[model samples]
Target: MTQALRFRLATPQDAVAIIACVRAVRGEHYPIRLLYAPEELAQAIAYARLVFALALLPSTGEVAGLAALEPSPYGRTGEMGVMMVLPTHRRRHVADDLRLLLVAWARQHGRRGLWGEVLAPVADSPDAACVSQRFTENAQLVPSGIALGLWPGPGGERQSFVRYARPLPAKASSKACRLPTRHRALVSEILGRLNCPVSFTADSPASGAGILDAKHEEGLRSWVLAVPRIGSDSAAELAGAIRRIQTHPDVAYAHLELPLAQPGASALCELAEARGFFFSTVTAEPFHDGPGLRLQWLAQPIEPNGLLLLNPLARRIAGHQSREQERVRPWAVAAAA
Candidate 1:
């Protein structure tokens, strides 16, 4: 059954075929707006900015499966998202082939880790997104955390994502992470699963200049404020940024990423949590210079109880995050109102 297809890295010529395969599998709800743009997508593929391993039906040269390998800004990690196979190709090893091909390409390109976000189900079909979870688990990737309400729909409705992770040999970092004991326990559990070495610091270092970068998602009306270095003024800078961002009535939310392995990350993190940001997840990949401790501040409130997670680990995360969300729920509600 698997021998019926040919798998290889995609080129600009595969732009039409990839788009068609995505449409055949998901129609217009594919959510990746890049698929709708032919020229830019082709350019992205040509430049290697958007790399894909494609499964093609040699008889007709039609794309049967698609898997992407998106490298992060830090270049230490590659995101493995949506090894999608058309419905007609189900029960075959088409997805497995595409997944393996993408993994091989990532290794050849020096990607140390493949810890990425798996988009949670949308409001319409909450369980439909589990296909990726099945694949992630099959690849021996451990499910660590959930970025609750991370993805946004065209109608302003937001969805969540599971943190799927599998770190390669080169990705193991022996860095010491500083955090409160409460967060430290879960993070420790997750890190143990990834086999990443870690030691805990007794206290968060005080006083440095906040070194960070802020990027916005115009389409999703969200922001990712990444703090690589925590300075004495980081909390202030973040507060000012949050105030400015929230002033935009249509802006959905803001995500703050702190370098967990860095010394004052927890101190700055504590301050952010006080300012209405709540736990999202400890990112599987390295962000800034190390693993990111991510927190989110939403302009709207989402019912955490409503999450429909089938996997045991996912359900466990839902429970943990439900409590985390509760701590900051009042602040989010007041801001939204």
Candidate 2:
């Protein structure tokens, strides 16, 4: 029996089905926990700010898959979240269809880009090869970082994530943002290779800039630092923030998001690199409209050589990370001493 698939924006009525789908995919090896409760999900859907899409069988209205464009904290980007297809629907192009639907929704909503993170297998594993091939078609995947203890297995397991981005076509009047001098070479290299448009603006740093917000996720042992602007005093502010983050018990990773348009961005980025931060991804501006650089610092060691990198850009970033870590190791050790 052939069934027609219908894709539509989810309403509050679809919350139960969406939650069920999420729980079903999670099963025994739940890689991540759902951040929203069913009631919360329903409320959020009713609010109509974040867009969730449901793939259903028209005959019985059975939800076959689900995807969502979650609003970023900074309001300029939408993260592709809760992408799942039923086990029975696997390898049937449902995922691709869902991805397209999500992208279209993001574009309709004026998102600069759509970002997603996929769990990848370890290097040399048979599953790694298969998964790599799966992402090879029409996906720009970048190797992110080792998410320690992110998955559940026999005891527990960690998974490496591959981050991918898809930029939407901007308005004709939108001007390109300036690329920082220190990161220009690498960023240019990345832009040259990827099919995404990442524009930056070079402008004077906003006055009285400092850390605007910070959030810590206990589950991931990660801290996200948001900086509205990076000015001359950013170094002192960031140093204090990093010191606090490092001192946090069981902290594994810290991420900083800074506006790419701000003046002194390159200088601040250089300072961050000296303090062990490395480029992770380019995301939409958090505070205003533009692109921002997402940099990460890991307190724990990462075995990049053991990661399964499907994209060339991912591999290059991983290599750069390894080299940067090595270059900063001695300084970190001596500083601690």
Candidate 3:
């Protein structure tokens, strides 16, 4: 028997159904102990602001899945979230259709890159398997690398996560920067300012960035950046962060915010440039509960993929668009000394 399905953009009115679908899927595929409340869902929708939609079965007008695309300050980059299909709609190409639709929407908006995280089963059991393999395979995406272990919660206690990527067809004109492990200390310090609670510092030259886990070490989510000593608010602190980057032979990198509202932020950026660092890519908080800012370089370099979480959705979206090699915004290179 042939089946019929329909898809459309989701609105604020559909928030309840979207939440239900996500919660149901999480119960089976992920360990989301703290689910979002109704107000939280509203806030997430507000933050995402650009293409948020739900999949609907035309025959019955039932909500089948939820997907969204969000803006990243980085040029031509956007993040994908809430890609979920209801329990009843799994294994039916519903996700494939929704992902393709979201990609088309992103390409139309001039966004060439997309990113999302997939969870891996921490323990060897059928209960913790990664469920979105089919979505990545159908899109013909390439695995930039694995995230290894990134999960929320106490140190040594977080679950494992995976990073996936797909280069957009339209990004042929775009070039990404690649940095080595030596710059991890420098990048860590800059990103630390925007995302605290998880800070990094270089302990020894050979060790690179020595990740301090307030809890345990193994199995915890380690923040990998070129520079160390993130989250400083003083000139001396910034100086130290720069020194670390300068001394390290690795590529320099850091994620900085616009620095408009803060005091002395521009001065710090100025100091960074003098010390041989520049602006690379913009990175915002992963969730609504985090800070928003760009990852500025102090003395490190930029990664080849342009982001920590390589976006598979970006390429998938690029495949559905007609535009090829269109430029959006130029990379934020540091001013010359």
TM-score of each: 0.81, 0.79, 0.47
Choose the strongest candidate by lDDT.
1
- In candidate 1, position 5 carries an lDDT of 83
- Write model 1 residue lDDT over 1-337, tens digit each, in one string: 5448888999998898888988888787654678867897899899877789998888899998898887766536777775678888878877677878877888787776677777667435746667777777777887777776676665766877888778547446666777767677767767666766566886555475767789776655778888777777787787788778767787777888788777778787777776677777765456645666778888776665576555676676666667777886776665555
Better by lDDT, candidate 3 or 1: 1
The whole-model lDDT of each prediction reads 0.74, 0.64, 0.42
Residue 177 of model 2, lDDT score = 52
Task: Tell me model 1's lDDT, rounded to 2 decimals.
Answer: 0.74
**Following a full C-alpha superposition, what root-mean-square deviation does model 1 have from the true structure?**
3.8
How well does candidate 2 match the true structure, expressed as C-alpha RMSD? 4.0
Off by over 4 Å in 3: 1-3, 27-35, 58-60, 120-139, 152-157, 170-337
Candidate with more favorable, higher TM-score: 1 or 2: 1
Worst 10 residues of 1 by lDDT: 283-292
Q: Which residue segments of model 1 deviate by more than 4 Å? A: 1-3, 116-139, 152-157, 167-173, 202-211, 218-221, 229-233, 308-313
lDDT of 3 at 337: 25
lDDT of 1 at 241: 82
Which candidate number maximizes TM-score? 1
Question: Which scores higher on lDDT, 1 or 2?
Answer: 1
lDDT of 2 by residue, 1-337 (tens): 6576898878888887877777777653343433336776688788764577788989888788887777776656677766778888777888778878777776676665566776656776676454643564356443333332233334345555666655445323332655445455566455434343455555555456555578776656678887776656777888888778766667767788776766766666776777777666665444474557777777665666567766666667677666666766664444333
